[model samples]
Target: MKVKRYVVDDLPQAVQMIRSELGSDAVILNTKEIRTGGFLGMFRKKRVEVIAAIDEASRKPAPRPAAPTKPIVRKSEPSEESAIPAVQLPNAAVRERYARSTGTSDAPAVRTSAVPSAASAVAVAVPAESPSKEAPERGAFAVPDDPRPARPVQAGAGLAENPDTASLLTELRSMKEMMVKLSKQQTFRSMPDSVMNWSRRLAEQGVEAPIIERFAEEVNDRLGTEGADDESAALSVAREVLLEWLLPSAGSGINSSTRIVHFVGPTGVGKTTTIAKIAADQSLTHHRTVGLITSDTYRIAAVDQLRTYADILNLPLEVVFSPSEAQRAFKKFEDRDLVLMDTAGRNYRNELLVSEVNSMLSPGEHAETILVLSMTQKYGDMKSVASQFAKYGVTRLLLTKVDETDSYGSILNLALEYSFAISYITCGQTVPDDIRPFDPNEWVSRLLGEPAYA
Candidate 1:
């Protein structure tokens, strides 16, 4: 099979090229419109790309039956020249005209001379004349003693009636049907002008298209149902729907009997610093007995940094290298009212590292696992990063670096997408001063571009 691709200005040109190169047996496999030569999507030219194929074996014409010839007569005394009977055949032009006149072309004219046998004359007679000569010049017809198999009458069918042509038409119809279905889908995907306006607004605010579409669709539905078509009414509906669907994470304070908190997130997400701030609050501000355990032994000077905070707060800091050692450290701090576990910030995208961290903390046994994400990162990246942490265990969301960007769409986006509770928001790097528990109403107001709730 020979397959080719052609890009042309229109369908007719593509068809002509396919016909000239692949002949009548070619099949169109696929076609699509493509745009090229655009700078920033301006002044682009559209072209049609067509894919066609031809099966080399199917393109060969089926052999037709030759015209019957008379048997050659051989004299008892054979002359040298008479020994081989000279035969002449009609040229292709004569054969074509004969076919048109009689509605058949299986038979052609053949002139025969006297010879010894039917096979000898049949072989020797045909080579005697040039194929370019006319039928009359080739002489009269002859019938052989033993006739060859006759070509089927159906072999003379027109090009349109050919089996290969029928197969090609079927393929073309299938491609046309597929193209129609794709066009319908393209039409269905085009959004209304109002919906598109909202989509642009959300995109400017750094919200992903899928999330914007979901909100816009719901807003439109509510407006239609309430018999309101105004833009302000639509915006109001959108805000209300978003607020209603934004389910804030809910949780009770840690168990009074024993409290353990583990902080986990990707690299440089402020996991260690966040833990320090929490430790200072629990020990100094809340006046509770707090012990700190860190499995951040992978990096240089990590223990020193945490130890400095531990020394200032006068709290015991135990650094463990392995999961078993971590278990022992927890056992040693069992008498304390609260034990804060700070894990090293590594690539959580690596499943092995996440599993190792899970083993080290033994989360969900008695401790609350918090996944920390940064508001500075894109929502698209945050979703993937959060999912990797979610695989092990994540009870709450500890969103950090809120002061870095005014847009807080990532907070709302993650809340709706993953269904995880927003636990705390860390705005600045200040220990114990910048971190605060999440407030649902205040966050919703910020997301809607309104004044934050007091």
Candidate 2:
């Protein structure tokens, strides 16, 4: 049996992975948990472990000969239950097939009678038979040690009849593959030299071949570009690479006809302050008549922040208590070129409150709901926040604290997966100087091996 750990968030990766691997008849035995181990031998990350095996014990030696890749890796491979340890088994099919073909009873067998017929090569022992012959599902097995096909091969020198031992080793290798891909994805996105080297080190270990190829392609693209200056082009390339991750959209659910730009996110995310910055930038520099509306009535002194900016610029400030009041405030700003609305930060999962706030800031015809994300925030937390606000009609994004985080992997994830234009980035609380324009040339250079900027 073979098991593999994949870090992707969903199941398509698991199924496509099995098909790309063990072939059509590969029977999935069991799938469950894994600990993404760390320096202290690590904690569990609850990743899904796929336990799969080919139904036919090695038919012929694996069509592809095993490569003596690099860095000696040792794992216990038992030929049969209670048997002596064998050399590293290339694929479960190869070793098991060898045992079966060599007339050795060490290999387990499949009994047509034992495994539910519906399961076919995948012997999950589904109690219900498949209505059709072509759609047999072997994924329904309840036993963790369930056989891919059949049999009993538990009498040998020392190899116990444990089904998980072999799968665990394979899964470890698979995890190495996933980590390598993750490093590659991050490298192309962040261009962190350290990650590129880590990818090299993992390659010396046992990451999968296809994953290696894709990573190699990214690295090759970096080096092969002709006349590409690294040092000076840093900013431009960084922007381009980041944009590739972002791949801006044609506008999502946001209605441009509405001119209300609402900044809402988790508490302590600088939502109110950032709104002040954008409002000032637009009013002072862009020469646009910016109107300020605050719906953060719950938090004391929230209005003070926006009011301070309004006082300095002589811009009108709208303080609203209810979503209905917020709507009326938007009406007052209807004639202004830009309306910057600030909402009280709340628990993102508090859908009821978010919906109410979203309803208030709903652009009449010119405003776009742009979620403000802090670079200093944790990636998982950021993803959750993004998902939560996604339901609130957020289509554009404004990244804050560019100077804060060194590892921006989550930014890459959001850009690649979600089509959101990063309108601007702010490094500090300063309204004008801290805010920088979003440029793609800088993004691409950084992605293609440019050095970090000063």
Candidate 3:
């Protein structure tokens, strides 16, 4: 079977990639997406990784079924309570006919015996049990030894006179003893209950089964290693992953001396809201004099949203409906320590939208474009947003609606694949507090498939 893995933003593209590489007989094994690169995986976009394998078993024909097994019996014991065993010869006489000769009297010695043949012993021992815990069938796994058929026998005697039967019983005891020792060294396993769920999650995101199996093995080996050093190492890796975000607190292409930073993203991604929050942070927390400008003419309430935030903070609001208007607005706030522009959300897939966003801050301006992306967007859609907006001169990325999604695996692959810096993440609808600066370590912890805590 040919098993392969791929990471993309969309399911159709992912499936197409798989079919192009492997044939139609391929069976999907798993899918998973881990965030990577930077700017909350703004670089690689949202990735959906898929793993598939071929089914070789179906290529050949089926085989015929086999028959079932039954049981048998052999001989009996002289005394069931006797501890010492008796040794009997094969084809021997049924009983020693004493002509009033040497026979023990006082208290007759107890004689323990087994079936005269191994075949009968196997049958009787197996069939006697009902194949249950408490009760069993008749003579199941009970056969012991077999006696010679051609021997002359006494009237009332059983098959205990067979010497060969006695020898066969001795060999069975030795084999059973060996089997007991071997069973102790082997490992026992039960089927897992959540295999399908785990597999489905991985399959949906495009992670290969082989990698998951390897991780499972490692987790088993390190199940109980919760030392200080291990904790520290895990935290360190997490921090680094979180650092991949380009939140303004993490620093980006612009220096602190720059006065203008712009926010851009798809419609309804809270770009204007996030920009106002950042501006408020600068004015209240950092004590930096900040100004706000809105260039969102495509939607009716887009400017209204920014206007309300500006009104609450007593901050100046400039509405720019075109590129020329944006340039004039920049000139008006040229002296401010920080000027945050809220551009109309630009669909990265729309060529005209990406072009318009790029033109506003591309020439004769100190503005740094910050791309605001949604965390809830599917991986492929996220990628499309990133790819389209890249040409719009977005200097860093801002991720909104962080608390709404459960899986953050797409972030890892994005950071690893792209170098975009993440500026901030918003976990709630509130201003300021909901929007916090990005921390690589903290983000990586979240990206590592855990809540944002040590």
Highest TM-score against the true fold, candidate: 1
| Global Cα lDDT for candidate 2 | 0.59
TM-score of each prediction? 0.57, 0.50, 0.48
User: What are the lDDT scores of the predictions, listed in order?
Assistant: 0.72, 0.59, 0.60
**Alpha carbon lDDT at 175, candidate 2:** 100
Model 1 clash pairs are: 69-142, 69-143, 70-142, 70-143, 87-125, 249-421
Candidate with better TM-score, 1 vs 2: 1
Candidates sorted by TM-score, descending order? 1, 2, 3
Task: Please state the error at residue 130 of candidate 2 in Å.
Answer: 29
**RMSD of each candidate relative to the true structure:** 18.0, 19.9, 22.1
Model 3 CA deviation exceeding 4 Å by range: 1-255, 362-365, 449-454
**Model 2: per-residue Cα lDDT over 1-454, one tens digit each:** 4554445445667778878877767766776666665667666455666767775565355664333232231222422232222222223453365455556655443322232222232222222332232322222112222234455645641223445766676788899999988986775655445334534433443333444345544544564444133433433433433444445632332233446677877777788767777676677776788788888877788889779878888899988887688778877776887788788888776678667677776554565677888878876677787887787557688778877755444454566556566777777877656876666555433334346542
- List where candidate 2 sits over 4 angstroms from the true fold: 1-216, 221-258, 443-454
Candidate 3 residue lDDT tens string, 372-454: 88878876777777877765545477788888876665554344445567767788888877887666656545534445452
- The order by descending lDDT is 1, 3, 2
lDDT of 1 at 243: 70
Question: Which digits, one per residue and each the tens of the lDDT, describe model 1 over residues 1-454?
Answer: 9999999999999999999999988999999999988889999999999999999999999986654454443233443433333333435544554456557645354343333342443232322333322322222222233444344445536456778988888899999999987875564365345545655666666776568767767766676744344666766676677677664564333445547988888777888788888888888877789999998888788889889889888999999998899989989998888998889888777788888788888554567888888988877678887888777657588889988887877876787777888778888988878888877666666665654531
Which whole-number lDDT from 0 to 100 does residue 63 have in model 1? Answer: 85
